[model samples]
Target: MRIGKQNQAFTAIATSDSETITVRGLDLCDDLIGKINFTDYFWLLVLGDKPTEAQRDMMDACLVAIAEHGLVPSVQAARMTLAAGPDAWQGAMSAGLLGMGSVVAGSSEAAGRYLAEVIAKAEADGTDIETAAIASLQDHKINKRKVAGLGHPQHSGGDPRADRLLAIADELGVSGRYIETLRILGKHAPGIIERPLPINVSGAIPACILDAGWPLEAIKAVPLLARAAGLSAHLFEEAQRSIGFIMSHKADEAIAYDGKTSSRNTKAAE
Candidate 1:
């Protein structure tokens, strides 16, 4: 069966021939390989153009901020996978990346969408961003929904990474409407939700990157790319020290089987 939308048989991202490779209209070897850094290359690859100094800086900062967050579930999963296989690094990486869902590295994309919705609500209601933020947050509260990017389980006081990224965005003069909306949400979300919901790095990332001209669709890419590096490190360590089995054993010890008792066990006990 056909999918929802018609697929276009083309990709403007890259092309290759016998002689040379081209990416975003630049020769990969001649014009881009050494001339451009990975951050700039990432921007070009995604947005079809090179990043400005501020964009590059903002992107770089975000990447660094989210790259390695100690033994997050994804990292744990990757490390464990590597320990199990011992040779299949690619599979291990895939295991890690596959876990980057809405609750993990992908939360930035949700936060970006949340910010965009606030902007849209403001424009629609003919109110300021702050008012729109309040209304949207209230709606979320009424529906008993969690606002993305507003809280961190580990950093209840506040996410330091979030603070740093927003500060960086301000320094780069990219703390525009999206960042404004994010701040408004941060200010109001706690009061509406009747709890402390300070912004986290996930929230900060979307606000900074969206304000810095990144598309909302690609917000998740930042964390994914950064976590790839983190996963590599964990996988290397797991290979050397062999903690995958240790983690598996720890998990086994931690979780108790609370399901229905077996019939054989009941008969034997009787």
Candidate 2:
């Protein structure tokens, strides 16, 4: 039996024939291959239109800012997967991508949604953005919920990448309500959250990109695409100077076992 009601598949992304290929209604070879950068192509593929100069620059900056993070857990997982099965590079990449959950590389999407919510609440209540942000932060504090994209254990003083991204957004003149919301959070977060939780890269990424008109639903795609580039590099190195097994060995050495003893005397156990 058929699975669903639809009789034919549909996609506006691309199509190919004997002589030519089209992407978002543009000729791939003649119009895009040599003319557009990957970041612009990415924008066309996702939003079905090319990005403005500011949007493209902001996107490129974010992609570069998040691309590699020096053997983060996801990188380690990818490396270890490669070590377990040296020939399966795709499997290793999948393992790495799978590790990007709420706590790791995926935090950008969460922050984007939070920023959107604050903006929406302010618009609904006819209040200023800062007031709305403060209220949302206070609510998170009371509920013991994390205000996503506001802290980094390693960058306690501040995250340089975040600082740089925000600066670029400001310089490009793309800073908007979301960026303002993020800055307001940074300013008042200590008072509400009771800690100096500065704006992290995750926060900066969404703020800048959203101001540049990226959809909230696809916020995660930015980091995912960027990390894929990083993962490819890690996998390439794994093929040559393999460290997957080394990481596994270190993990084994680091974790201590503290289980129950065998049910017998020492001589019997021996």
Candidate 3:
């Protein structure tokens, strides 16, 4: 029954006695309940401190921007899981969360890391941020790796959410090196990548939040948290309208099987 470490379970996040609950050393009821919103509370939970007003606003904007992109794959997965087992709401939610990987809601983290790399290289080389950004884009192009968070298929002109978040960052005076780097990348991407790869919301999120002092490592948390709210809404609607199986049926109708005939089909042919 022993695990990696015996008699040494520990968590700095929170603890509670019968009389009180604490989160990151703050009294949950007394210090947090009405004094902070969920986004600020989330920052406290992750980074062990409340966010500045700019940080909170930037975070809130990113959260709102990413939440509820309707019927995305993760939402579809969650709805379908719920349809299969109507009683297991937890399972449905789990299905949705599990589907958020590198290609989907998880791209924010990758974009954040890439931005950080550009900033670091610029700092190290004593060149301007724009130069470093273009160089980084060139590297990605050379390697045939995707420049994460650059383009949106649906928003070919540009991502409105991304523009709004960056504007909010500027209004709040939190727009800094990362945000500048992101803009530089966007400016140069068409020339370097040979296409108009405008900055998407995923890219904007990390740039703004990172400039606001969020840890780059935790950038994915922003989207995951936002999508959880979206998924909850979806699952609730699925329960009410029962569309999980309808989505499944739509998928069946959308795709044509292009393989060897099934046994029944082959028998019919014969």
Candidate 4:
């Protein structure tokens, strides 16, 4: 569908002959063997436009942030679906994508509401910011009790992506109010917040997106943006693995009427 014309030639030549230049074998028509980079070729094949240097850098940053996660819910689902059959890679990858649709995995936009709620509470109370922050932390720990963004099963201490993202944000001249809030809390309310746990990547990603002027609702789209790449690789792996051919569920277990058997186990299994 009229993709692009950059390092490409218009071929009206007949394909019935052995001299045809199919999309699969178009190395470099003239001397055709300079080892053109796959990254450049991939960008050319898709998008229909060459990305600017800055665009490439940002895209590289985001892609590098989540290239491969081991046995995450999505990856687990993908592998499970893949391990059953040879040609089920697409099914397995689709299964993985389904598991990733959430605010917690969706990143900053979905998190904006929670951040705004906490910040608004501080602003509305008009009390000392440090005091209000401490109170909010306590209240959240008790009442609302909801947290979104930044999951690190492998790296328990923190997310490695956060530092690189923050550095890029600084270079992009993005004002990070979300990150600023953490700094404020760490400096002033260390007794309650920072001492217990540190600020995470999701917290700063919100600031970076906010600096980009995107709406808070945009968080949900990130899974589609991010996991899609992972899904592509996973589907390919599943296709190669000869697993995940069919989908089936095991039979349900017996349920005890009273306390004879551990019904709690049944419920937990569910």
Candidate 5:
């Protein structure tokens, strides 16, 4: 197949029956030359677009933000769950991904949709969204009693990553009213903590992604990819520390236990 056309920095042209990835007309195994961050490489592969410097920075921060949570259930689960044997990475990753299923992780996309609906309605109603969001927060407060953004488990009082993401949003001219709402809420909430209970990275990223015209599920996929990255890193360290231990452990073949072990979280399927 012979083809040639281009969009982003490099163009791809099918030349010959190649053995591996042939970027452009040159053999990736030989002629390809460049230095790029994982974010850039990831973007190029998945998005087929070289992310801008700003985009790369935001993506990088987001990736690092979720990498490791210091024995958060996921980390511990991965360790204990995967001590089972040679295919440890699979089990560890499964456990790590399991933690991402929490409300804290799932809430952002829900909140994003909430804001999106509110904004669309507000805009369509001949009213500004900021004013409407504020009003909605106040009027809906008694009934719903939910904050659009603020307060995090890890940050306790606030998340610094939220601020970093907001800066990127501003530079990118992305919709960040949700962020402003978080900030305003943090400052004014009764007896606000020292850290101000700022929104975590998840909350803001959904907004950023929404503004970028992506589905909520898309933002979620990003974290999974990043979590996999984190898992690899964790497994590398874990394997190095105890190769023998990892190899020695094995799953007890289909135990008929009436209860769960601290290490075994499995339950009887309904």
Candidate 6:
């Protein structure tokens, strides 16, 4: 069953012969192994070109900012998966990564798209970015849609990680329209939405990296990659100290069953 267009025939990422491997036109062992750092290499691999210093720094900062939030749901899932199958780290990692969705580590893409929408609206309507942001947010509120990358549950006042990333982007001189749009949205979001919607790390990440030349389509990859590091740590600790069952036990104790009792059980008791 063919789903979509399949015209392209070859992968541009990498290829190898028996004796040598090539990545984006560079020799893997001789040209890239020791000389290029992982951050630069990541940019090269994704964009097919090396990042400038500011881009590299911004990317590195974002990766560090999101890497390990303390035992988020994805981490818990990974830990539990490892506890269930002690030998399958890959399974545990997949379980963790698969848990990332609109609510969690995957929200960066939503935020990026939101920023782009605001920018597009401004350009299309011949208005300022701030005006465009306000209108976009108002549309979201009217539609009862979430404004992603704003209002973290724990960071009502502000997300410290977000603040730090924005500051770093400014320092690196990568604060462009996307970052400006993010700040404008943050400033006016509360007034428009009738509640505080402080910018979060997810918001900050897309703004900084997009300003630094990351494609919006690849925004989710940043958090996914960062959380992979975090998940690996949790899985390792689960293997060592084993808290997966403890979390499961705690959850069981916490949630009360509210379902109807079986009539068969009542008859048996009677």
How many pairs of residues collide in model 4? Answer: 12
Using TM-score as the measure, name the better of candidate 1 and candidate 5: 1
TM-score of each: 0.95, 0.94, 0.92, 0.58, 0.65, 0.96
Q: How accurate is candidate 1 locally (lDDT)?
A: 0.91
lDDT winner, 1 or 2: 2
lDDT of model 4 at residue 101?
52
| TM-score ranking of the models | 6, 1, 2, 3, 5, 4
Q: lDDT winner among the candidates?
A: 2
* Candidate 1 residue-wise lDDT, 25-44, digit = tens: 99999999889899999999
Q: Tell me the lDDT of candidate 3.
A: 0.91
- Per-residue C-alpha lDDT of model 2 across residues 96-124, encoded as one tens digit per residue: 99999999889999999999999999999
- For candidate 5, the 10 contiguous residues with the lowest summed lDDT are 243-252
- Encode model 3's per-residue lDDT on 173-231: one tens digit a residue: 99898989899899999889888799999899999999999997888889989999999
- Per residue, candidate 5 scores C-alpha lDDT tens digits across 33-78 of 4655667666665555567776676667667766655555566556
Off by over 4 Å in 1: 1-8
Best by TM-score: 6
lDDT of each: 0.91, 0.94, 0.91, 0.54, 0.60, 0.93
Residue pairs with clashing backbones, model 2: none
Cα deviation at 153, candidate 6, in Å, is 1.7
Candidate 4 versus truth, CA RMSD in Å, comes to 10.4
For model 3, give the 10-residue run with minimal summed lDDT. Answer: 1-10
- Model 4: runs farther than 4 Å from truth? 1-60, 85-90, 101-104, 107-110, 123-132, 144-156, 185-190, 193-196, 242-270
